[model samples]
Target: MSAALPHAPARALNNLVTQGWNQLARVYNSPVLQRVAYQPPQDEIIEQLRIAGIRRIADVGCGTGILASRIQQELAPDLIYGCDASVGMLRQAQARSDQVRWINRQAENLGLDDGAVDAVVSTHAFHFFDHAPALTEFHRILSPGGLLAIVLNNPRSRFARLLQPTMVQGLAYFPPPDEMRTLVEAAGFRITEQRPVRRPIPDQLVPDILTVARRG
Candidate 1:
């Protein structure tokens, strides 16, 4: 089991994550930053969604609506919604497209009906989430057999370890692969896929983790 973070440090981390993401809302979608951030496993995720006959999907932690917009165009889902905790981020997303239903909300408290979506995709933002609660919320919001795909920084990587201090300083966290899987499974998901991919950061390459599961 993972060691629990101290209350003070945990709160500090949450604050930093909230502030940093809100601050990054302005530059998040820039081509430079996009290249640095981990990209989602789009092909695999799309294939899974297609196989499951998904009609409605939500992008939690949908920054600037980039992934949500792409899913809208590519998958052509009937309803594509985007939610984020930061108003600044939501503003950017809302500005990008009118087709997506943009909601300013936390991952743990998504103001949506139970089983309202067929799938939920979150990219490069898991480190900032309150894992247990967010996963529970994901399970609650998803239809039976609904999919959950998360793309996050891989803390197991050498590069990521070197970057941990900075991230921790910012009040974010990168959970180990096993820990993340456990949390998801404990939240009532059945893991289907988990792996890592190398993504280019500004000055170096960093590993990104991908995990896909189904609400069971």
Candidate 2:
């Protein structure tokens, strides 16, 4: 259940990287995170590898490297890359014990070799991006039949509707699950599945969708 909490107070940034991290990394430490985010259980990641056969993953919009840190611990993909436009968030992701590789990049320009990753995963960060450019990057990075899973915060939920007036209007473009499938397909992804999960995020009505898609 998403609790729909408002964004938090400002963070102190020592550099541009810190400034970028402030834009989204705040979620990692926010007390409000409990409701809106569904951190995939470690077990599901293992299963994703077995079920979907993902080898390497590029986590776009990887704020604070929270999920990547855990993915490094659990899946330890042959290679894992966390990409974000925020230098601050990249710094935070890189600072996490040096195991995670952080990239100071945007969703539109991955700067990676074509077909470099087996999968791309994002958590609650897509709404900030220009969808067409970001999806183009997703297609560019994936090998044929590669997977893309984006877990976005759902605004249709009670908490999101209540909090929308303040959380940011950009989210209006990111609709609920079925509609999202239509978007994904329009972006050239063959959606394989759409699974919903309930996460406990304080002050939000939280229902998350882990949309599974494959490159044509």
Candidate 3:
């Protein structure tokens, strides 16, 4: 005779994972589901830079350096720096040789020289910068014509709704894409491109949006 998994037992296990991600997302300033959706917003960043001819990058608020590592492998940025507010997450990020320089600092106020980097990117960390001085810092570090890619999760989806009061209601979310474009353009970036990076899960039917742009 063979044994099959009990229905409730499976559900309980699933709940543990759901709860873990939920709690993580709660503490997380960025979107957990969106970050994991499609190899995260970092991969999209590298592809855009490849198109734009950027050779260096700075990943502000780079949680665990998920995107930083991808950029290092794809393009071999001569100068790559990963800065974040959380020392704990910064420590856990993949670090090997001179591939990346990880610094524990706030993104809005990067203390780097003017036009220090070729591009600046972040995945799902845009809304976390309402009062943080990092937006100007992004402009300070980026060279003229450098690419700036910011990926945020679009909460307008059925799965986000089903989660109901939890995700949509709890997070300190900002307004829609027009507002994001307005803010970035006001920060001196030309706002080159914007679109959704949709990653579909079979059971959960919400798609994440990965927004990309440039720094003029």
Candidate whose TM-score is highest:
1
What's the C-alpha lDDT at position 53 in model 1? Answer: 79
Ranking by TM-score: 1, 2, 3
Native-vs-model 3 lDDT? 0.63
Candidate 3, 162-188: lDDT as tens digits? 444434533335336777777777788
TM-score per candidate, chains pooled = 0.85, 0.78, 0.73
Q: Which stretches of candidate 1 lie over 4 Å from their true place?
A: 1-15, 40-44, 198-204
lDDT of 2 by residue, 1-216 (tens): 012222222222213333545675645656445323445422344456557767688888777777777778876677888777665566567777366667766677777889999888887677666677788889998999888878775667765666575346332256678787887888789998777654344434465567778998
Give one digit per residue, the lDDT tens place, for model 1 in 1-216.
012211222243566665677688887777766655534345446666778778899988887788887778787889998887766677777778788888767788887899999899888777788889889999999999999988877776767767677675765777889998999999999999897644334323656777989999
Candidate No. with top lDDT: 1
Better of 1 and 3 by TM-score: 1
After superposition, the stretches of candidate 2 with alpha carbons farther than 4 Å from their true spots are: 1-27, 30-38, 41-46, 166-172, 198-204
Where does candidate 1 have its weakest 10-residue lDDT segment? Answer: 1-10
136 Cα displacement, candidate 2 (Å): 1.3
* Every candidate's lDDT: 0.76, 0.67, 0.63
